[model samples]
Target: MDSSNWAEHLKQDFSKIRLRMLEKLEEFSILRLNPKHFYSIKVEQESSLSPLAELASINLESARMLHIKPYVVSQKSLHEIEKAIKKAKPNVTINSKDNELICSIPEPTAEIREEKIKSSKQVVEEARIALRTKRQDLLKKFKNWYPSENELHSNKNSLEKEISRYLSEIESEWTNKEKEFRQLK
Candidate 1:
């Protein structure tokens, strides 16, 4: 692959790490609610339809409430949105009022924050492992590109620096999210 392709692959790998964290979409944090988790929800009795992100606009109404206003504003769409949310997160309580669905997230207690912080650390560590694995795979590919042993070693070192840079980006994001969870609302 060319240098441009190499850069794109590295960028995509970083994004994959972020998307993996969104696998825990059932959690109350709106930041973790990536489109990947809600992209498949069929709405309005349609076999093929837009995803939840397109069907509605989500607003952080409050620390404990997320307001979702559908663009079409139909009863069937409302029910479908409600069903999608319920299917995605059964524990969250959703109320419909004035053509909007309000998802009631539980108050973030200290225990919950602590639990989330722990889990966030675990997820970051998993990302680190995944990154290392990706680096290994990339190294094998690089070996073919760099025939000389010394040249391959130099490229491997540069690759390690790039991997560390991506890991630091993930680390910074996790720390910020942890701080957000620890905030007093």
Candidate 2:
């Protein structure tokens, strides 16, 4: 393959890596009490489970509070919702008040923040591993092309630079996310 084609392939691969990294970072963010967290809950399918979002209307009563009111009020469904929330373990306080569930998200303590940081680090490490795997795959592809020694060496240098650049990008994202997590009350 020509240098141009190789470069294009690398760009595409790098783009995919970045996209996947972004998705992982989003998951890390969802570890907190955001509306997106509601979407993460999947109800059981014995015809007895339904997603919380679908069963009720969730509203942000305040910056640290959420109010969920089910459209069809039933004790069983409410209990199921409560059970689901507890099972998800979002570290929030759940209260059933006036036929609605009030979820209070507490400020993150030092220990909680530390846990989040550790989780974020794990996610970043996974991305780094993925990047390394992609780099190895690219190297193998280049080797199969039977390029000249000089060309191979030059491509290797370029590939290493790309890998370093991506690694740094992932690190930067983790650093920023860590800061945000720390700043969370």
- Give the best candidate by TM-score: 2
Per-residue alpha-carbon lDDT of model 2 for 91-136, expressed as tens digits? Answer: 7789998888898777767886688678767877888898899888
Candidate 1 C-alpha lDDT tens digits along 39-63: 4555545766567888888776666
Q: Which candidate number maximizes lDDT?
A: 2
> Could you give me the TM-score of model 1 versus the true structure?
0.66
CA lDDT of each prediction against the hidden true structure: 0.73, 0.75
| lDDT computed for candidate 2 | 0.75
TM-score to native of every candidate shown: 0.66, 0.73
RMSD (CA, Å), each prediction: 4.5, 3.6
